[model samples]
Target: MKHKEYRRVVTGHNAEGTAIIESDQMASQMLERPNRPGVRLTNFWLTDQTPAEYDGPTETCTGDFILHPPQHGSVFRCVEFMPEDPEVMARLSSEDGANAFAEMGAGANIVQGGRHPWMHRTDSVDYGIVMNGEIWMLMDNEEDDVLLKAGDVVVQRGTNHAWANRGTEPCTIMFVLIDGVTQAGGGKGIPPR
Candidate 1:
């Protein structure tokens, strides 16, 4: 599989309190899907909180990074999905594929029991920008599935949803997930933190 490289440049303060480039390098982590051929994920950056200042070089993140939603003040990452052919879709719809996907989701600690095969909900607001190709965003309720093309953006709240690529080309999406809390009484209120 061809891997994608993400070059990251980080800035920090110098001794005289002047901003300078702290580090610049290509990201090293590239996660591949076992069940779904051609699917890959590259986590470019992550922060535990809304950082007050640039401390130093970003920490190297290991292991599965997408198991759960971002915590309070946290931000997740960007992932790319390769378009699935009919064979791949059939495999994904089979029992073995379902089990494999479930295991993968478990490793990421995603919430289980979505209506679709990979349906799950997160307690965060996700900003998704389609960088290439076309894909469908499947929701859990009455809203029609949204077909997103390159350059389209979707603001995803805390909702149960899944992504489907019915085209013949790969789709890349950049996502920044911000932590949020669902208001009490199910009124769609995210109260001030």
Candidate 2:
């Protein structure tokens, strides 16, 4: 289940008012799920607030990947899911694996009181681009699952959903999550299914 390494290029303005490449290297902020060994996440960039002009070198963001989005700004990340069999999916949904996933920072009962282990909702509008392979986007009810292929884009509003890659190859998707509030309750939490 080896995946390609992701490279990130960051730019900034130098003190002499010149544009400079702040960083050009592989993304280091990566997390791997122990239970689902093939699940990999790489956080590229995060902004805690609206960005202002920078007069110094790029500062390392100290944000952690929470199940929720940033309160005021956004986060850009990429996820890779290796092809798995039914047995692997069963393991992922197992109680032990689910608990481990929650401990790994997934939202708590974020989707209808945690009825589904991988189904969770965040308080953000997400723009997702399928970078490689194909995957399925499963909604709360599971009736509207959509298959997306490379180059496909999905606008994921604040909703309870999960991603599944049932193909034979790995799937990669880049997502940008922007803070948002649900209109019904004017809160960051989505309504229960």
Candidate 3:
């Protein structure tokens, strides 16, 4: 269950030794907690290094973030890391997102990472559930901001957002998504996605 060299544009760092439990069936469900329903997972694994990948044009990102494509472009996950600076986060979430150029939308979520990190997409709706660690949902739109513990869920839409990892340790989550644009600037790389 250790994955090495896992890289994904949607991910900020890479995970190693992943143990995925593919099944939306009752088996994957934690029926013990009705408040926290079971989740349908596809690719789940483990990793050692977790952080922002500094490969982009900034120094806030580093680590091995990977995205695996199912046969025939089915759908998958993308993880990312943001700096401690809100200003930097804003820049990355804006038209000049230094970390990414992809237009993510629909079927997305925060699977793992820091606490209170901002999540969004330009063309995809997100669905996220915390696997380990803790996080706080910024609550974009007219929703009440909520804190996500070990077992919390979040659903976000295509908009401008950011995340704040307010934990002594790195925060992590498990999310599922599909149908998203992987290009910046109208998905054609013309500038502005």
Model 2, residue pairs in steric clash: none
lDDT minimum window of 10 residues, candidate 2:
107-116
In terms of lDDT, the best-performing candidate is: 2
lDDT by candidate, in order shown: 0.66, 0.73, 0.36
Decreasing lDDT order of the candidates:
2, 1, 3
Q: Compared with the true structure, what per-residue lDDT tens digits does model 3 show for residues 69-172?
A: 22122223423222244544443323332223222222233312312232443344456676655655554442755666767777654444544554543445
Candidate 3: minimum summed lDDT over ten consecutive residues — where? 28-37
- Report how far off residue 43 is in candidate 1 (Å): 1.5
Clashing pairs in 1: 67-108, 67-109
Over all chains combined, what TM-score does candidate 3 have?
0.39
- Using all chains and alpha carbons, the TM-scores for the candidates as numbered come to 0.79, 0.84, 0.39
lDDT string for model 2 (1-193, tens) is 6977888889887769798898898888777767556788888777667663344436444555554456777878888988767775664453544465575465353454333446766668899999999999887666788999999999998877777788999999999988776766675555533
lDDT at 142, model 2: 63
* Cα lDDT, model 3, residue 152: 75
